[model samples]
Target: MKPGSLSHGSSTAWGKALRRPAALQPHLPHVRTPPTPRRAHCPPIRCGQVPKTPFEGFVARPPNSELHLGNAWSLAHACELSYLTQDEVRSIAEGRWGLKGLLCYGYGDNDGPDTQCFAAAGPDFIVVAFRGTTSITDWVRDLKVWKLPDGPLGCEAHAGFLEGVQGKWKGRSIIDSVLQGVRDLERQYGKEEGLAIYVTGHSLGGALATLAAAYMLEDPELRDKVAGHYTFGSPRVAGPRFKKRFEALAPAGRALAHRFQNREDVVSKVPAWWRAYDHVGRWWYLAGDDQVLMRNPDLWTRLRDIIDIDWDFQPDFVYDHQLRAEGTGGYIDGIEKNIVRSA
Candidate 1:
């Protein structure tokens, strides 16, 4: 089967399978159902590490002209590039991605690096990509589900994600460095030339990207410069308050932020609703069989989908979170396929 293809009748079967057992059926009013599953106890899954040469043997495809698919493919590649070493990233930025004046940050932090991001400029745009979980420390951070009450926009957010965005290196926070890079790019190319800013990442990096974009949007000078923020397999990073603030800050009629959730990508479901965490921005659900839902499915639909997941497949959670180049059931693969279909 293709990366995003589902077997026939799977959805209907899953929905039917979720019917309450006889013991817990409505007729048995005296019977109590089992407690809901606690996802907190589940061990953290490792985010995939792409091959050292991520772009090797792969040609950059012209993106479909549609806004979402075009930006999705480009931002997905930017996220893939985040995993490379600085030199390799720089070389590829200029050669493959056609980027100029690259600014790489968060490398060589032996003391303990909390985040990594890079800003690369093209003739008409700039992309800020955040690196996803790549170390034991990253996994540890991912497990830190605690919320900080005083996060960005004066709303609550995942403590670890907030730290990743606000943590300082050499007296400068990650967002600060990223903004400085953006400013430099605007000056070099002339903001009059309409240099749009795009922020993106996968998994843990996606959380940081969302937070970073939120911070940028709050800034008067940078707010209008932001074109869009895209994330893949990103877990919930903020609470309802933050979501409200983000929606207010986002431009009217323009979907400035989008979260792409691949089929059964467990990372996107984390810091569960029970923890008061909520996702920000429009959701794009990549249902198997080349179907993409622009909005989140209803609760019952989501529940049924969860019940239908193939848990028998070992490492299913991690497998769905991968960002492989293409044809490997990864985010990039899914987005590229969507791009082809849209074309």
Candidate 2:
């Protein structure tokens, strides 16, 4: 399958599967039910990091309100956005899908630049999604969070992430692109009908999305228009100072800012608590029913369930990062089951 193809069993599959679920699965329920078992004759699943088979049943545990199904779908959408190419983005724009593509901006001018993201508008919401680092060099960028750049935004952020978000793409600032996407949506959809703006991504993309949402919230008008900021497998993006700033800017209920942590995902724990970096806003934990080993975590608690660094070095680290297979576990599986039932 190509970069943007809707290959079965990947994020793209979820994107196509969910395109019109509004018509089919009117409400993505948060119930638990077993998935269909695979036939004995089927080949042994090839994917080892995460289970390829969907989980038997799913029961969501949102820290605050009932699991926000809309937030779950947005996460799936944001994940899919990371897979799209410029051409495929155009195809989605011209198609009948509920999501209309707007921008696919990236400064791939050099070998490995830490700047790339996209934006889009639906009837009632606008989405700004950042693509996680795709190259080894980009991964190097992920590690360089040592210095705080001088700026009016005194709150210190993950140094690399701050630079990535502030960098220019195609002669225009990436932040400006996101803001412009929202403004264009407002022009087309009108800000009045309770239109929402969602900033989301997975992994590094999630970090950038968090930064974008924080900046948006600083503007009183934008804060009211935003419905939620959702991220999957996102790392710590700021220190306590910025955390306090984010809380004051958006608060918990003002606009939902949720970090969906997959069970044992080692990435979410990085820029570690020991390093004094803190996760902002609410944490909605997603793990298998059997893996319900963790209760809600406190600010200083090192994620109790994360695969420990001292443990055996292996693929389990990578497996924990995968979006739970269709029914295996995590937020997407719940939405997948609901879609199947609706169909």
Best by TM-score: 1
lDDT, candidate 2, 35-70, per-residue tens: 222221211112222222211111122333233544
lDDT of 1 by residue, 159-218 (tens): 888888777777777677778878888788745646778889888889999998888887
lDDT of 2: 0.56
Candidate 2 residue runs with Cα over 4 Å from true position: 1-67, 93-96, 107-112, 149-153, 251-255, 289-314, 324-331, 334-343
Q: Please give me the total number of clashing residue pairs in predicted model 2.
A: 5
TM-score of each: 0.76, 0.70
Please provide the root mean square deviation of candidate 2 (C-alpha atoms, Å): 11.0
Supply candidate 2's per-residue lDDT for 217. Answer: 77
Give the CA lDDT, 0 to 100, for residue 274 in model 1.
88
Q: Candidate 1: how many backbone clashes?
A: 3
